[model samples]
Target: MATSKSKTSLREDLTCAICFELFKEPVMLGCMHHFCRRCIVSYWKSVRSPVTCPQCRQEFPNKCCFQTNYLVANLVEKVRASSSPASVKYLEKELNDCLESQCSMKDAYISMIRKDKDKMEKIKKTGAELQGRVHNDFQALHHFLQVEEEAMIEELKREQEEMLQGLERHLEALQVAIRDVEKNINILRQTAGSTDQSVLVELPKLNSRPISIDI
Candidate 1:
């Protein structure tokens, strides 16, 4: 018997069409193509409604096209686990690259969060300052209104007192005029009772002159 020639090729035995990464959850599509289930599912989610196979671009049934092949998935995991040190080193390099990229993403996320917090703090400070200004303005307006109201009340009191004094003066003058008229009527009544025609004649002249009281 002759020595066996190398028949298997590394390219055909271990490779993925898309992403070129070691398959994690390998799924066999109807078109005889292989891909990680999660990756293909994400690819299908980008499309509108109807789904299709990522490899051959062949249209698939709605919602139920993506299938999981546990056999292939287990085989890929076992092969990667049992790989040589050189193969593991290459995979480790890719994983380290991914870890570095994740570190950058983490930095970006942290920076964005810090910026958002700073913006929020600024907004809070501005709101507090504006509130203080509004409060001061309201207090000033209240003080002004209070002073004006007090002034108006004082003026009204003064005017009311003046009106009351004027009204009392008018009442006193009216009472004096009424008393004088009553006295004149009494004098006329007395003269009528007496048989004195002279006094009656003098009464007409007294009534024509203005009354004067010296008190």
Candidate 2:
């Protein structure tokens, strides 16, 4: 295994500052800023006179002032080859971990779906029970209203019949009084026409009785 510091150092040495790639046909300048041979040649060709390093800008005599860094090139190739095996092993482990995570999530999703289904069933059952209770309550209320209405109607009828009976008794008493008055008028007319003196002197007696209402 490589320590983090060593890995960082190796990565810095293996990479080229000019093209920012892994060194290809590497070369070194007097400034010690390593670059690819072709990259440095192309960069220096852009400027006239003494060429400067792309990294530190240390002036060189001209474009033809660099030497191949053979030791760095050999080290880069070895490090790249060795890190390849480690990269392959890490990728394999990562793939296996991703597969396990996916399976666990799938199971969780299934369990959540089942729980939601149960809750929905319970809710539906409760809704049905509530509906029945509402209907029953309204049915009882309607029955109570109907019974009260009938009882009230019966009471009204009884009161109306009693009032009618009292009125009939009053009418009968008035008829009897009217008849007696007419009879008395006939007797007075006969007395004025010189009927028997004794009969005229003895006037008819009148009797009246008030009707009674039982309420």
Candidate 3:
């Protein structure tokens, strides 16, 4: 009798139900089934009605039934490793490569973060300087207004003093004219003591001359 060769089955654990390929951006459905995110998205776009499970035939009222299944994907890899050591070793090598790439990405991200911090500090300092300048401008404007107000008050006071002085001068002139009239009346009274009553009455009818001054 001829010895039979044992058949090695390929891994169906990482295979996606939707695309029958390795699950990239794998997402879980409400029916607990795994599918690639792009694959499920494409299926959703093609469907006329609400999305449902292809395996269990469970119908969902809406197409928003898919979600990320990171834990399940990790579990699937673990299960595959228990069955096949070669697949596990291959997956570990790929995982190491991914880690190395991520390490480089982290270094770039750290440098970018440092740059952002420096930029943020510069912005904060500039903002503070702007605030100080704004405050100084307001203070300067306030002082200017105060000075203008005081100047206006001084001008008003000067005008009032000038008006009062003019009124005093006018009053003094009126007083002098009244005194001269009284003196003339006294002189007429004395002159009338030796004159007749008819001449005294005629003295009041005489025109008085106005006094004038240069200053």
Q: RMSDs, each prediction?
A: 18.3, 9.6, 18.7
Q: Which numbered prediction scores highest in lDDT against the true structure?
A: 2
> What do the candidate models score in CA lDDT, each in turn?
0.73, 0.83, 0.76
Per-residue alpha-carbon lDDT of candidate 2 for residues 1-215, written as tens digits (9 for 90 to 100): 36657976897878988777779888999988788898988888877767888888888776878999999899878767757978858867987899999999999999999999999999999999999999999999999999999999999999999899977878787788678777777766766687567656565564445545442
Q: How well does each candidate superpose onto the true structure, as a TM-score?
A: 0.53, 0.52, 0.46
The residue ranges of model 1 lying beyond 4 angstroms of the native Cα positions read: 1-90, 197-199, 202-215
The all-Cα superposition gives candidate 1 an RMSD in Å to the true structure of: 18.3
lDDT value for model 3: 0.76
What is candidate 1's lDDT per residue for 1-215, written digit by digit as tens? 12112212332444566667667677777776778777777777777856667667787777466578887777676666647698778877987999999999999999999999999999999999999999999999999999999999999999999988977777776677788778778877877788867655555423333434422
Better of 1 and 2 by lDDT: 2
Model 3 poorest ten-residue lDDT run? 1-10
Best by TM-score: 1
Off by over 4 Å in 2: 1-83, 188-203, 212-215
| Candidate no. 1 TM-score | 0.53
